[model samples]
Target: MTRFLPPVTIALAALVLWQLVSFIAGSHSVSGVVETMAYLFRMMQQESFWLDVAESGTAIFYAICLSMLFGWALGVVIGLNRNVSDVSEPILVTFYSLPKVTLYPLVLLLFGLGLSAKVAFGVMHGLVPICLITGNAIRQLRPVYIRTAKVMRLSRSSVTFHVVLPAILPELISSLRIGLSLSILGVLIGEMFASKRGLGFAAVNAMGLGDGTRIMAIGVFLSVCAISINFLLLEIESAIRHRTARI
Candidate 1:
């Protein structure tokens, strides 16, 4: 069903709908979309846009790595230790439920709206989901592997490396996919709130100038980036699952 529909069809349908709305209602909406596409092309022609993308991408990647490292470790510890899970699960849930963006003022105060602030925001956004998902995934593991390792008299480090880590890696990757998107959003927010350059800066500037088309262009660019990333992640995840199943 999914293959039959094709993702590009959705894009085509959306564009058609957009054009219809613009034509029936006003030219502004249609022109805005076209203008946005033009701006996107214009942006592609310049080096600055690419540079800004790289900078934002770097921030997001860093945040993802940091979150994954910290979150995975904490999740594993919590999952393995009943006492820790009991004590910390609720705390983690509370933080996860709360909107991390609400901490913007505090983050800006501490990090002063620099790259530090952006990284901090990304970390906050990326951490909780990774932690929760990793913990849950690990928690669901059957004890067969552990039991086998114990019966075989495997050393603690060996058992953990050869058994536990592999079992939970897929979960960590799944969490990472979610966290990466969150981190990207965080970086854009940080840049929008206070930064000299980045896609977010472009967006803020567009709005300030009442350049709705440019704003829409920025939005379209972000959407394309997001869709591209999602497709890549999905492919990688599917490959991983297939390989794991074969093993």
Candidate 2:
């Protein structure tokens, strides 16, 4: 219960601020919290809304899986070799620093407009951070772990799976959490631009119609979902760190 206080307080404060803003802006410009929630509840009752959610959800799921798979694999490879890490680190950093939106045209050109484009855009957003973080974490790992694996005459795959991966599990989880958020953002952006369905499209449509209530409702829904997932991941990461510390 105590653990929940900060977030609860923050939420209440946010609602209060929102109400104040709504009052000042007038109901036409900004919806009150209650009005937004009411609109969200109505949205939830529609089958079309669920279908849009399913579309976005599927894209998010695929993007996350692909990002994790490729990110982890490439990160492991880059981390294990000193020469590769030294050479690639600067390049990866430069690429990651660039605004992902700038690459949207290229992604659309390559993937075309559809779920594939959305997934690819998401991977573009997520993959680099995970790879960079994982690679750096592996580079900073205790040398004794590697020496032990070498002494055991373990195969490359065996060493990675049994030693390196387990050792960097905490860092990996942290990178994953970051990557997941970015992937969701990427997918939503994709939906906003060239997609016909999804929550992002719904939000965009609402914007064009000047429906402040619907727009606020969608924003609130996405914010709450993202926050909940992030909190859950943070808890898991914390647990892993604690267990690792104990060991």
Candidate 3:
């Protein structure tokens, strides 16, 4: 009971404040929590809503898989070498700092205005932070661990599999959680820009029709999805950390 009290209290307070503001405005331009929830319930009954969610979810899934595969591998390679990290770190940081949305035009040109474009856009957006976070985590490994690997005369693959990966599992999992959220955001952004189907486009359509309740409903749904994923990932990370400690 105590563990959940704070968040439940804050959520209730926020809903009350939102209702108060919406009542004061007395316009359809803003929706109260109750109205939004009502709209969300209606929307969930529609097959189209599920289709849009599925489309966005698919794009996000593919994008995250690609980003994690390439980003983790590159991070490990660069992180294990001081010279490579020194040369590549600045470049990676520069790319990470850039507005990834600006590259959407180029990605669209390369992949066309289709599923490929959305996946590519999302991968680019998510890849940077994962790569950087993983690199930093790897670089932080204790010198004693490195010495132990060398003392064992372990091959590169053996070292990575048996030592480096386990040591960095917690930080890497956290990075993956962040990466998943960013990938979803990226996919939604791409869908809003060009796709015929996706939750983002659904929200955009609602906006054009001046259906504030529907727009808010979509936003709330997306927020809930993101929060759920984050919570699940956190639990998995926590479990791994506890197991690692026990080992």
Candidate 4:
């Protein structure tokens, strides 16, 4: 209860602000909290809503898996060699700084429409932060750690699982949290631009129809989901840090 209080308070405050804004802007421009929540509840009861959710969820899952796997592998490889890290870091940073939306046309051309496009967009958004964070964390790892692993004659797999992973677990989790959010954003953008299905498409359709209530409801729903997942990730990271500290 205590742990949840701050967020609850913040949510209430945000609601009050939202209602105030809606009142000032008039209902035509912005939906009230109650109205949006009602719409969201109704939306959840519809079969089409669930279908959109399933479509988006599948894409998000695939994107996250690929992003984490490839990002971690690349990060580890780069971090293990100072020369590689120095050479690649600037290029990676430059790419990451690019506005991803600008590349959407290219992505569409490569993957075409549907799940593949959505997943690719998501991977594009998610892959960099994880790689950058993981690589920096690895670079910061004490030299003694690697020397000790080598001295013990540990196999490559064993060393990675026992030493490298544990040492960078906290940073990895942080990267994951960021990557997950970006991946979701990317998928939604893909849906809005290139796909006929998913929550993003629904939101875009709502916008086209001037259905402000539906748009607000979708925004509220996505916000709640993102916040909940982020909170869970933070808790897990904290627990891991505590356990690591004890060890």
Give model 2's TM-score versus the native structure.
0.97
lDDT digits (tens) for residues 172-228 of candidate 1: 677888888888888898888788888888889878887766777778889888878
Error of 3 at 172 (Å): 1.4
Which candidate ranks first by lDDT, i.e. highest?
2
Question: Residue by residue across 1-247, what tens digits does model 2's lDDT show?
Answer: 9988998999899999999999999988998988999999999999999999999999999999999999999999999998998898899899888888888989999989899999999998899999998999998999999999999999999999999999999899989999999999999999998889999999999999999999999899899899889888899999999999998
Point out the worst 10-residue segment of candidate 3 by lDDT.
Answer: 26-35
RMSD of model 2 against the true structure: 1.0
Deviation (Å) of 99 in candidate 2: 1.3
Off by over 4 Å in 3: none
Encode model 3's per-residue lDDT on 167-191: one tens digit a residue: 9999889989998988998998998
| Local distance difference test scores for all models | 0.81, 0.93, 0.89, 0.92
**What is the C-alpha lDDT profile of model 4 across 45-153, one tens digit per residue?**
9999999999999999999999999999888888777999999999999988899998999999998887998999999999998999999999899999999999999
Please state the error at residue 216 of candidate 3 in Å. Answer: 0.3
